[model samples]
Target: MPRIRKNPTGVDPQLLVKDAAKLMPAPTRRLFLRGGASLGALAFLTGCDIVDSASAEHVLMKISYFNDRAQAWLFNPNKLAPTYPDSAVRRPFPFNAYYPEEDAPEVDKEDYKLEVGGMVDNKKSWTLDELYALPQETQITRLICVEGWSAIGKWTGTPLREFLRRVGADTRAKYVWFRCAEGYSTSIDMPTALHPQTQMTFKFDGEILPRKYGFPMKVRMPTKLGFKNPKHVMEMAVTDKYLGGYWEDQGYNWFSGI
Candidate 1:
């Protein structure tokens, strides 16, 4: 008779599965669960032994990368996130950031210049007036956060695809990266960047974007989780390199889509 292999590290296999599952998106988690949560299966998937906590964590990280790929493959650029009417717009949209509202970076509109670089024909830096002069559009969309809360707000800005075209960006590039004045940075896939709804937002609710909401500009991607929407953007680059984001480096899934 074959003997069962007991966990040598005393860490409950079920607990390890639970921890890893928590980091996955709902649909992926359900699929994972349906596939079976056995430690042997996880070991097979990660190609590592589940003999210790460290190995267990490595397995989880591998699963996270798997989740990222799965979500990216399943994403549909043509599918638009739902939009709301003016009456549904949340009054006093809640302020959110890693820092306090008072600490939001105060950018001077006159001196601010958005530096553009990487895989583009036009590498020129753009001033506030130049950006604002571009044709703009508005959409009332919900900002869904990973922290379990959501808010609908009106955002007005230039479609990122049009802006990319105007800048002579290589549409075939793999990623579009953004750097913010507040030391926050993130990158998104080219497909999402070219999505019609993804905009370089300059105004919120028919007024200049408040300092609390990223004064000069913000990238409003209703298709992604709130944190994926970078605020106080100062620089942008089109690249094939995989430059990880602040949260993404901390183990959050890179291809986080709603």
Candidate 2:
């Protein structure tokens, strides 16, 4: 039997457990609550005595990793996210980012080029016109944010799978990593990268994507929470490496599928 140590002075063990639960993404939290998991159970499962915040954090991170794997395994690659009509699209879509809207990167479209690398046969950089020339599709899907707000918006872009095929990307690669002009970065599993609803978005609301909404280009994934959809995308790489994202590195789940 695993030994459970008493928590430090003034620290409520129950509160610690509740705090850990709150750190989990919504779906994971629901599953955790449904299972009736508790601090003692977590310590027993991890074989670690949670005597302090450090130990508690260690245990919670392990559970988070487990949740990530479970979500990824259960993800249905073929299932499409629900789409709405233009009438359902939110007017003046809310602008969101880590920084203020005025601070958004101002990308000059004429000089912008998307640099592609890694396991793709064509490591060529593509210009705006070139990307726009690709077969484009539009979807009015809900953008679910981890912060709990959601908005329906129309996005138009090349289907990511089609773009990957055009670039001769290795479909078997483990992950597709992206770099944004605003110093944000994120990665997604190959399955998510190939999802039909995942797009390399160039237009929003039938207009060239505005600076406030990731001008030039954004990797839009209706299947993922808003943070996972990188805007102002400048570069991408297909690789087997696990390049963690900005939020993910800070303890947010890596496989944040919705």
Candidate 3:
């Protein structure tokens, strides 16, 4: 069984701020701390001037939002994550989720139908065969987990942008949200959704995606953390509404970009 990862918020506020600060590059970290953006300084920005748990949490969240914005601004939809040769791909990629491995959802492919809704010209549902018949693309990319480990895996699937275009999705929409078979849901910004490397993957390691790795389909996002790449995706929608993710609602950073 995979070890249960603790909630990021279980730590004290000062420690949380310091940990978040580490995510910044060394030079940026130095500048951020020197600019009075440290935890001691953040207490003043929250208008509380007190380091109470509630106020500290709020200040840390604001800084997280600033980090998200910075990452989004630096993201390049055209540039791709570095790919590895097949020989360099990780063997037996690690499995991760909020639950144990034995509890992974069992999808019924025979009866599976991908529901497409929201801002689109055609809200037609799709079958596994229909999705497979769409133009297929393949790439070898690393799946970087928030837990500080990463694995290189080859994936085969349709370009999400092409699939969205076929379904007449509103490309101008602000967000693309997905519902998974295992009750997991998440959303991504429009630009990231259309990124060249963002694929609606059906195969892993050159074979049909096993149930352990999101059978039926998964959104393989190399540019984002593993949790941001949801699995067993069953439904999708294009909308401007902000749908907080399962972890996001629990105070995990919403825009957890790589």
Candidate 2 structure quality by residue, lDDT tens digits, 130-244: 9999999999999998878899999999999999999999999999999887678999999999999999999999999998898889999999999999998989999999998
How displaced is residue 239 in candidate 2, in Å?
Answer: 0.8
Q: Which residue pairs clash in candidate 3?
A: none
Off by over 4 Å in 1: 1-52
* TM-score, predicted candidate 3 vs. hidden true structure: 0.80
Global lDDT of each candidate: 0.84, 0.84, 0.80
Error of 2 at 30 (Å): 23
Better of 2 and 3 by lDDT: 2
What C-alpha lDDT does candidate 3 achieve relative to the native structure?
A: 0.80
Candidate 1 minimal-lDDT segment of 10 residues: 1-10
Give TM-scores for every candidate, taking all chains together and pairing residue i with residue i.
Answer: 0.80, 0.81, 0.80
- Lowest lDDT 10-residue stretch of candidate 3: 1-10
